[model samples]
Target: MNRPPLDRCTDGLPLPPGDDLDSVGPFVIRCVYALPRDGTDRRLGEDGTISRSLSAMQAWFAAQTGARLRFADEPVRTVRLPETDARIADRGSYVRDRIERLSRRQGFHEPRTLYAVWYDGSSTISCGGGAWPPELRGRVAALYLQGAYDDVVCAEDRFSPDGVAPEINEFKMLHEILHTMGFVPPGAPHHTRAGHVGDNHNDLMYAGDPPWNPSVIDPYHQDYFRTGRTDIPDLARSSFLDPLPAGAEPPPVW
Candidate 1:
């Protein structure tokens, strides 16, 4: 299917840049790992793994969009968040509130592109989880903070000791970030309408968990950013979190 010019958002919003993005220094997205108080055995924040994952993801983004992603050499921040329900409704706010709290406590940096991944323990369910308002299901695996395009919620079960590999977890993290960057493919009708990359299971942005190796950025996502389309759904105002509060630090600019 042919990719359409991004006209998905009923609301007017500016799509984040992909190719047009020029950075004085390499673009850096800070990732803070907030561990659960009753944390389990997930080692997502391990230095070697985290560094390698960031390098791999950065390479992919650079190869696809001509954007440079600089990984922070410092250790990932370990934080504590008040416990909250795992349902999507609560999870969204929980992630945002934590990001806000961390920002206030840690202070903002320049060239704003920050992500906080809250780590729970593990997911018992192999299938997805959701009830009323079907949209609220297993989306907790990871989510791009709808409007901001900066923050993301990385759910607990995204990794596994038995089967899932480190690179796989990294791929999931990269996938969610793409969503935030407005990588929803127009060629995928369901993804365009349902807010997931569903047309091809092989694509990194696939609605479900993709493989450990990760796929290249879909062509439509490339086109959307390359063409600088500014009307994508991911840029729409979030129906979830309230806007940033007053006295909030502004995001860093390039």
Candidate 2:
């Protein structure tokens, strides 16, 4: 894969992680900025919005679970789509799938690597999408940045006791990453047909109403993150966590 100079990326993306495939650990999240040939490069990944949101996400995760996710070595990177804006932007339901496949072709698909693409392109689809573990073969998820185009940074004051504050972008990106990681297993008490917690609208994994008000990750602590049971899968045991064991296990096949 061709990479721009270490100091900056192509089309002015944030400084990208080095292209050292031999060194990146398994089960890590790779952040990417994606747009089509004719699409404008907003460079949100560098302009502080994405960086701040990631900080908030890190804070939220560390606050909730006592560990942060293992992001790709470089905080963020960029990918220029092969197609023109018209062809890529209007993919609708196929957008995530299309982008994931395309990213794989660009060499983003390392074993156990989950993609978190911030697509700066329009789509008829919803704000974001993630791969539900049970049905996942592709290990990628994406946020349609054009939807709402929200840049809400974490409301620090309101986020301490409960993780309510996050840029809607980080919030949704985390949600998609969780989904791709096979969260809210079918055996979870509140598992829904939509692969979310059916019981709490405030829970991050809940499939709730408009004006999404997610505040926590499995408030019950019995579903996905740190479920005290061994019968069902647990994210606490996932290799995606920072400080995770070296040569960590790959994500389980659901």
Candidate 3:
């Protein structure tokens, strides 16, 4: 392929483990944190707002996995794949292509990772969300958050007498990230309501309401950080991905 060198094309992270193919190139994990252009009201409670919730979620992820996190403040237009001469045309396709290239390059022989994306537009309706590319049936090692879902409600609002709490935001962040990480596992029955339900939930995956239970943080989430099971399939076995491997020092956390 008449493309840029894979090293030049990548964002300088070590090639994730399973990616041994030069044509597929390096693995990249990008985040797009979309906030309302109108500027969210500063008074909303912590849990009522998406940004606040995302921060807490990111913090939890960072503390658990030691992966450096970055935020994107712009609209998600497209994500160009590494080593390909052409860029992915749309947001959904872009996400799919990236996963494909990463999986093949990283050697995700079984396509274990599952990619899922969610976008929040105006109104209380959680109408605009979609799954990752069908091609990425298994190798979806990571998830991305696309936009804001709703306004943050302040204590003054008649609906919420108390301000939104940080824990609530963390729970919301964890729920969505888990979807992206393929933590729900494949072929599980869907829920008909919202909120965390032990292994199941009437939650966002099933279009349920917010304020998910904090107890949702458990082995499913823990395995990703502690065991590297949550990492891109190719990279899962790499020293970079695993923290406690023999003679391997842990990556520095931010």
Candidate 4:
């Protein structure tokens, strides 16, 4: 969808271009999901539910970090790490190791603390918003209701019986992950009286009242990362994490 022209947020900012994982510090992330044993009865929709949801989540995450998305269809070999680190324990050591490797491969830095937790059933879950400490702010990532779309669909549009379609689930995943990354989209705040503008539905930041298709990427996101601004007021801040040390560079991109 087309987006209105944006003012540049990075003006006069000295941060370097591209994502450097080392600079952002170590992240503690967790991945949790509700899946059927057979994996056959998985919700099916435009993107076949599971794959689309995962892709959308990954896309949102990449946009947040100003990085690109890459996935391995085949099994990934994980390294064994010492269990003494508290950050590593929040997420399994195996998962942490995998994330580190993936971050390095993608030329991104792992957050100081990250968690990807998957959940099943309708449990009202929330991550500490911007109120989270700076040390922990960009360090967490999570995935919930992997196979089920009910919660996400219902949240977007309660009246529709097709509460949680695969596409909707994917969009919700993207939306929440963007939240974790610290980009609060327009229409997110209930009290805000701002009129809807730009690509509201396509963007994770925009409210999904009518429920736009998940496959479409919001141009505002590109504008935010590219020029680092959107018409939305709150997004004007340099919410992205600090830059890498002098002469430090991220590992080669995958």
Candidate 5:
């Protein structure tokens, strides 16, 4: 569905440096609305949903890490997938492998940029996928939004006022992006079998059967954000974070 002109709360928010450059800092998280050949383009980028939602995400990110995520710029990026919607759906469960197609683009494949992709395509679930930090083969976090466009992209319509979807849509994207950023490292105290937390179902990175009622990030601080443990990676130190904290160490070149 096409959005009406947006009177979104995109103004007056605490936005990071934006020049619309593909890459500028040591690390960046670029937002992209990727569409397949047969998919209808919704122009979520131009309409301010992506820009506004990501701003909300940064607000939430700061609450957790005291630093903001370094966004490439406003008016989120857009790309056309090499395959069709139907072809992408055929491999729905392996969504990451399919969405990784973006990494093939020179612009998207910059080693220091992690792409938070809103792929307008089909998948088995309201699908979102991220790479484990150790699995640094690709730097992409994708959400299959073909069916949940209204529920997810028209986030303001579904939940909250002012078109910000920090609770659900944008939160899901942040969860996936954190995963790609090497959060909830395997050695964390609550690190579930692998990439997520199992201590609390309400935890942002929980990977269990409980309701995904995410209200906080690494609530215990014993896992990813700022556990203060030098053994495992801490998200507070990720170079992708803007205004990097003092002496922040960049993650491996993914």
Candidate 6:
């Protein structure tokens, strides 16, 4: 009855409220703002873009998982300095330091803070873009923006109070949030009988194409939560088997 050598995380993911070991409660998201290394001169529209992005994320999570994901009501806290190398392996440390500083400022001892950064830079930092899950020490979910705040929540002429006006899309933000919540990597143990992962092509974890809406958390993901499986794979540096030859069958489920 041996198990893998990976560490077993006791944190309640996919659902919060860790008191009952199965209790589902709201997870706090302490939104923190940061600029790129050279973009300090720019003023961020925290109230407009950052606020909408977080709201949209909350809506998506609630619709998909029935779990309430909460955050600071207003955009009051923000990083004084730009994050150093937010797209690299050290991104977690950079984010963690900011969160700690924020916690100290608030004078709260133990608020579950997921450092949500409204980055004013290009997504090239992390190749395309993705969230740095909490499993990675110091890391949390983040939103990457290539342009100014207006690009995130602007209209044909001015700022729009409607909702998240993402320049790229909302899927990226949703994808990363799921990652932080212990969603399985794109492979077996998470796929369907047709070898499809993420419920289907419409799933948030799908490898490509298809927009974010209409996606959901399939039963496979539920199994992960219901069965108390907490070994969330670090997709950033996870080891894998060699690729199969052309026309060959896929590798067996790990």
User: Global lDDT of each model?
Assistant: 0.38, 0.65, 0.30, 0.32, 0.67, 0.39
lDDT of 6 by residue, 1-254 (tens): 01011112223233222232222332345665655455553454544565665556556655655454546565635554433444322333233233333333444323244445555444322312322223332234455454223233211212224453422235555554444444443334654322124335555555423423434545344322232333434222111111212222111111
Best by TM-score: 5
**Residues 33-87, model 2: lDDT tens digits:** 8887778898866775566666778888888888889887686888888877567
- Choose the strongest candidate by lDDT: 5
Q: Which residues of candidate 5, in runs, are more than 4 Å off? A: 1-24, 147-165
Kindly list the per-residue Cα lDDT of model 3 for residues 1-254, writing each as its tens digit. Answer: 00010101122333334322322322222333222323333332223444444455555555544642333332322222243222221233233334444444534332222222222112211212222112122223222222222443212122212323335334443444443333333323331222122332323233333433343333343222234443322112223222323433211110
lDDT value for candidate 3?
0.30
Write candidate 4's Cα lDDT for 1-254 as tens digits: 21111111122322222343544433223333322222332232222334445555555545555543333232212222222223322333122223233333433333333333232212122211111112122332333232122244233321112333334444544444444444443333321112122345554445335544444444544433333333432322332223322232221120
Lowest summed lDDT over 10 consecutive residues: which window, candidate 5?
1-10
lDDT at 195, model 6: 18
Report the candidate with higher lDDT, 3 versus 5: 5
What C-alpha lDDT does candidate 6 achieve relative to the native structure? 0.39
Candidate 1 lDDT over 1-254, as tens digits, reads: 11111112212223232221343443344665554444453455664445555666666555655554444447765555444324222333334333334344444333434443434322222112111012221111232212121232224324433322334555666655544443453533446433355555656655543322356555564332333443433222211112322222211111
Error of 4 at 5 (Å): 27
Off by over 4 Å in 4: 1-30, 34-111, 124-166, 185-199, 208-212, 215-217, 220-223, 229-254
RMSD of each: 11.7, 9.4, 13.2, 12.8, 9.6, 13.1
Model 4 has an lDDT value of: 0.32
Model 3: how far is 33 from its true place, Å? 4.3
